[model samples]
Target chain A: MPNEAVQYLLTSQRDDGGWGPYPTLPSRTESTALAALALRLAADVEVGARASATSGARWLTETQLDSGAWALGDGVPGPNWSTTLATLALTHFEGEDGAAAAGGAWVLGARGQGPNLWSRALGLFLRPSDTVELDPDLKGWPWVQGTASWVEPTSYALLSLKRLRLVGPAADTRAHIDEAERMLLDRQCDDGGWNYGNSRVFGDVLTSYPDTTSLALLALADRRGEPAVTAALEALPGLAADNDSTLAMGLVAVALATLGGDPEPIRARLRNQLSTWDGGDIRGLAWAAIGLLDGSDPLGLLDG
Target chain B: MVSRRRFLQAGAGAVAATSMACRGRPDPWTPEAAKKPANSPVAILGAPDYDETRLVEVVRQGLGICGISARNLRVVLKPNLVEFDPQGVINTHPTLVAAAIEAFRLEGAREVVVAEGSGHRRDSQYLLTASGLQEQLDDMGAHYVDLNHDRVRRTVLKSSFTDLGELYLPETVLDADLFVSMPKLKTHHWAGATLSMKNLFGIVPGAVYGWPKNPLHWAGIDGSIIDINAALSGRRFNIIDGIVGMEGNGPIQGVAKQVGVLVFGEDPVAVDATGARLMSIDPWKLRYLEATDAFLGNVGEDRIEARGESLSSFRANFDVVTAFEETKVEPSTGGAGGPARIDK
Candidate 1:
């Protein structure tokens, strides 16, 4: 099944050596990075996987902006959150090249803006019930600059920074990692899973979504022994079942597999679904492959 | 009527006085729009429920009354596919969307694309499937574009509603000859009412704006609404699904209230004003519509000509959250009520 998924990715790769979110759309940074990572992981057993991964890596490297971030691949301007994913992909394929380090530097420099004085004052003036209950001053990664922090991009940044740390010690990486970790922990929902941004909004305790919760848990895999992480992991099967999305199920399987929890049931479900999958969504296929592959921590999400 | 430039200057003056503390306000660039007489017409047609056959007839009739023609034009239907709700109140009903697709195609549209960038969720496939739109699209063989990841072109904001000078909006929307906003008529906790104009927020690419569109949230919801509508003025039309609406705490998390009507118009402001009126909300109380009334379109009852059914026939008071209590319209006494000029 993993081989078939890899074949789909290889067939779907554009002439520019990247993959798109869907087969018909132009290649994007996030989809390309995920596909490249999955391909590299399968390079050992799958034929032609290593060369395809290199081509994808080459596209990523060549398209790297002067600021060290990759613009969103479809001509949208960036230095956006996709930089984190590109960094992780580059680090995995090329082992800490200039492209990876520059991505780290850009990520470190890119922080979600803290609340302005006016907003902060407004927050102070408003009742707690009227506002989201999280520290706006604690900066995490935003999808783009000059906006508030969100969960998924922040998780990707933490993962990228962790991988970059192994190349050599950058003085600022640890602090960024620590702050991002705090940010993720701070935004965890009441139900033990994670939301896209805040756990609460305007007094409502928002529920968690499977994809976001899985990504956050994967990024926090090293802290698996903690109560919060363990509780979140324990809640995975339910979340996966409830969501039952290709991306959600794939991510949950990867998260569970990375944390030493049995992902067999979820994997079984994904395998069943993938049997009739159209291979249209490259990102979902890549994640499915990474989750269904016979290995723990195939993308080194846990190793970092 | 104030021009968009004059409105901007006044707003800039307000900003200056407040030491850069004011939110983005209206623009003053379109003199043509300002000079145009406020004869905006909105059609309110009754639709009892989600029967696609009946909805198609009602929608086609509404389109006819509104003088809309789809001859060889590329149409993009931007619906409120915000999130999944089991009770089916959060999003525009898929049956209504299917009806619109059929209506436009019957009107000779060359292409009709259903597009949405969901605010809360990033995975649009899950949203499409959960919202029952995937099956609908497949059955109809219609095209669906996830505007979140669509190719974008950087567009300058026509009005300064947000600090974001320009936004990377999806080309699918920008390229459409007739860009229709198909939104569920619902009460928004922040905006007081979510209708056609508010639904334009989904056109902003998530690739650029992020999930939930926090950038617009930061910029001021009312101002961003005005800005987005102003930028895409001439190409826009709206058909709101008011047959079933969410009344409390929505855009998401609200109780379903069946309003039994479909709203249609070319002027988004007028359409929304009619929508608010049907919901028993005073459009004048909504800041976005008020600001928009200045240059965008008519919000006054006397200024707009109602087509099809009378406003009183479908009017019902929708429940709103605590913050928007003042927005509810007081029930009329024995008076000269209803749209000033009702068309047969």
Candidate 2:
């Protein structure tokens, strides 16, 4: 990891011992978790770096709700989308086992059972066109409960579960992971990328976005032999080449490296991109650090 | 059983008798009748096309009708910069935003800032650059604040439609003297249609609500719209871009339909209603508009006065997807409130 990126992540930490998406924004769980994981992955035992990660992990553990989910903030809703990232960050610390386990259980229980019968009925009647095929019944994760499942939240949850080995030798855990995998595959766009969630809405095919595609690919790295995964891999290079988004570029690089594809070109491109970055964006800096780790399993608790 | 001439004669006689009886007495319903006058006026100007120069004049004329005076007002033009699509009319046109800034500046407004918290993407810089709004703002020397990362203050909702009793809105939204909502007139798969009122969804900070502002979605799209608009109350005005609007399934991912007009009004509900009329959808059918009629603005045609171009001249049948067609509410019978629909 570049020293400058690491330093940026450390300095951008809010006085509350959390990090926000950008320097000026209030600290958020997702940004704080990603930043903490990046620092832990750097594996520099220096006092300043270790303290930063510990403080961030502590914040995540403390802010966790009684239900083990972390709502977005004090007044937002349930920490539905943020729990996975927070759980992954907590696994980096030694005393956070209980919080991590509770969060993991909460995340496991949060899978959306798709829309109910009434909603499905409404959908069938209200859908603009039937040209695009999708099964709303496929159980997957939603960013929030009672809403339709989307790709990014599902992918991040899967990545956390897999990294923590929370999907243990139990049958239900295995089944849950298998269902989530199916859901991710089902949501993949025909053009080999993923959108927010649905492959199509109405008659129009929603365009696949680079950030969502990269996150989905990163979560499904072990299943690259699957046809959908292979197609996604084929589709990623062009997106990475064309995308100027720092976060997208970094995530794509990490995903590509994890999939045993060449990372050198992406790494070089990212380095060039980071050269122009001022590091005020803590989220981008965190992703850039993780990408620069070059195949290191930052979120994997057992890797070390 | 009566002849037509005899029926007309009887009706006239009854009216004359009632008028004679009420002549020296004040009618009990007079106060209520006086209170509920005609609906607010919404300006629908014909621009023919997206001529930047012509758009400036059209916007100026529309604002004039809407009673917007720029002198010494801190104006914030909140445009919908949801996402960028080079071939699609997804975001508000940069030319229109630029024109609004120029119009406000020419009116001697103290300040005009272009603001939006993009619900779909977190990277405001990228969205601004890709949407062409950044260059427009830069060229016009107008400030552009990403509401997603802007400093926010939590405001208690005393009469919220949603379960959420409070919202953390950006300081810019709360501080602006004149908050102008500039939404691209488009059809939405979920909300039926997204006009000025639906566009206010972008005002909620993404940092608090999460990208795509899922919390608002969970709170119920229609209800959330009511809640946010109610919070902003009297400070809001609307300017809708109907020059090249989206149809079918939209908000994103839809075909562009050019309607060649700009709709503006101080009442967001009325302006959106006018835009909906031009799109050939009944405003009374939209639940958010229906629910917010009394508090926000009335959607009733009898209440609204039209300015500039006539509605019939620019009306086009916007193709609503079958899914959102379920959102269409039947016209309501006159009651205490305006139109009402059971929540879906």
Candidate 3:
């Protein structure tokens, strides 16, 4: 019954695994995507964990509203947050795509532009079953845990494709990365953090915030060996009051350590600060719990 | 036994420095909860006796000098700005909000900003903008922050609800010396009626966990509400707006009937006790009553010192919005046209 937290999160699944109400739960998208991501983390922890994760993905697959579109509650099933997040959760499951055809049916049936979170996410996941084809600009989309309004949604769609290494032409990837990196580089807080500015879904309420900084840290850690990442790593210590905020910062700590960036002391410091969020809170708790468990001792997930 | 032993061992630092995050305590209503008998007095706050003007006065006077003053305090009025629209009684009304601002101002208040991290979809910003909150604040010369868009400071402070203090509140509210929550007396699906004590949860910054607004049902009401109530230590003040109380199912989708009464007090529990009594409900019986119910706040009918009019004076029968009844009421939408209004 106390799994009520997980239940509430799962109840949020769309016909796709992705989520949004935009900025938070009930607005919908972030919860679904993060839950999907959380499910992925739990699944990766144990083999059947992925099966537990798939229930949500299946919900997305089953709930693929008739008209071949998806939404949070009931609206025109446009290819926005819900459609895209659902696509990500369903396709990225740990198992083979036994339900791929059914999922693909819903994806192909989708209306609206073919470049939204749904369309872009689909292009990355379900393809010709050959090469990972992607639109050039899609590579540099902001990979935020939550949507970042126009820049973030587009940026996330673009980056999700890049993470899959599915970019079509390398030139487009460069352009996308350059654009996203420029946007990211300029917006870095003095403490090497980032937050929602005018481009935030929650209004202008997120300055001096750690959540966005964590996303940016994830992005930088993905490029851990880079100079920009070095600067971001340098800024993390100044921002730390404790460990929950350290997921993004911790990832960078490991990335920096791996890069031989004077990280031993910093890694230990952030590691001590971080706690196991394996319990419940937000979608990031799903990912961070896995990361923390893996960090303590490699259970062999994505971080390893 | 091993898990409990392990839990005790691992919980060393939990008691030390924790934040204002919801602890994952087993909800009392969970199937697992029946194992332990839920024994506790349900706190009740009956409606006050005073008229509208006096209701405000009595609450301020009741506040007295609880070791705080208006001139020195950076007073922040956090009304239930959950979502922008006032039409739905789920949020604090602009009238009550303005009155609190005015009252705080009378107490020689320095600043009063009515803020919230409303969970409404933001693509509907044009719609939210029409909530008339901005205009009200603009006219009143007060700051209106979409906590969704406000600056926040994250810390892991100590809390009774959870061991790790969970995630502390954002500095926007945490920084203020005093936080006065003016919540509407409405029926809550999870918490029954979201009175004074329950409304303070809005002050928790959503950014630390990544969501802009707290997902009410995420932990149902226990983790969210209990942790919120437990985090506040200072003598908090709550003024319940029951002139038109929401009944049945509420906080959002309830019908507002004229229950013309204002309830207020220093202790959120005491004030809410008055509110529940006014609604003809026993505070102990309400669903989301756990967090504050345990506080020494519950005042039984015999013991409760009532100053204003009693619940007997007004027996107005009002049908509140008990559940989600879909109306044609689309918020001020963008490309989406507004749902046809019934009044027109």
Return the top candidate by DockQ.
1
DockQ of all predictions against the true structure, Cα-based? 0.45, 0.21, 0.02
lDDT of 3 by residue, A1-304 (tens): 0222233345444444444433233324335555665556555444444555666565555656555334443232333334434544444664524333333334332211223332232232234222122222322232222222222333343333333333111223444456556556654544455544222211112232333444455444456657666666566545443333333433434334433345445445434443332222344333333343333322221242
lDDT of 1 by residue, B130-161 (tens): 88998999999998988888888888776665
Question: TM-score for all predictions?
Answer: 0.93, 0.83, 0.45
Model 1 clash count equals 3
* Ranked candidates, highest DockQ first: 1, 2, 3
TM-score sort, best first: 1, 2, 3
Candidate closest to the true structure, highest lDDT: 1
- Checking candidate 1 for backbone clashes, the offending pairs are B4-B27, B4-B28, B5-B28
Q: What is the iRMSD of the candidate numbered 2?
A: 10.7
List model 3 lDDT by residue over B1-344, tens digit each: 12222222223222321221235443222232121112212222233432435544544553442323577567877777654345546566665666667667777777776666554322212223445555567667886554543444444433333333444454566667677777887766445567776776666544333243323223224345545665554535666777667765455556666676666555565566556656655554442342343333443443345654545564443333322122112112111221122212
Q: How well is candidate 3 docked (DockQ)?
A: 0.02
Alpha-carbon lDDT of model 1 = 0.81
Model 1 residue B73 distance off true place after TM-score fit, in angstroms = 1.9
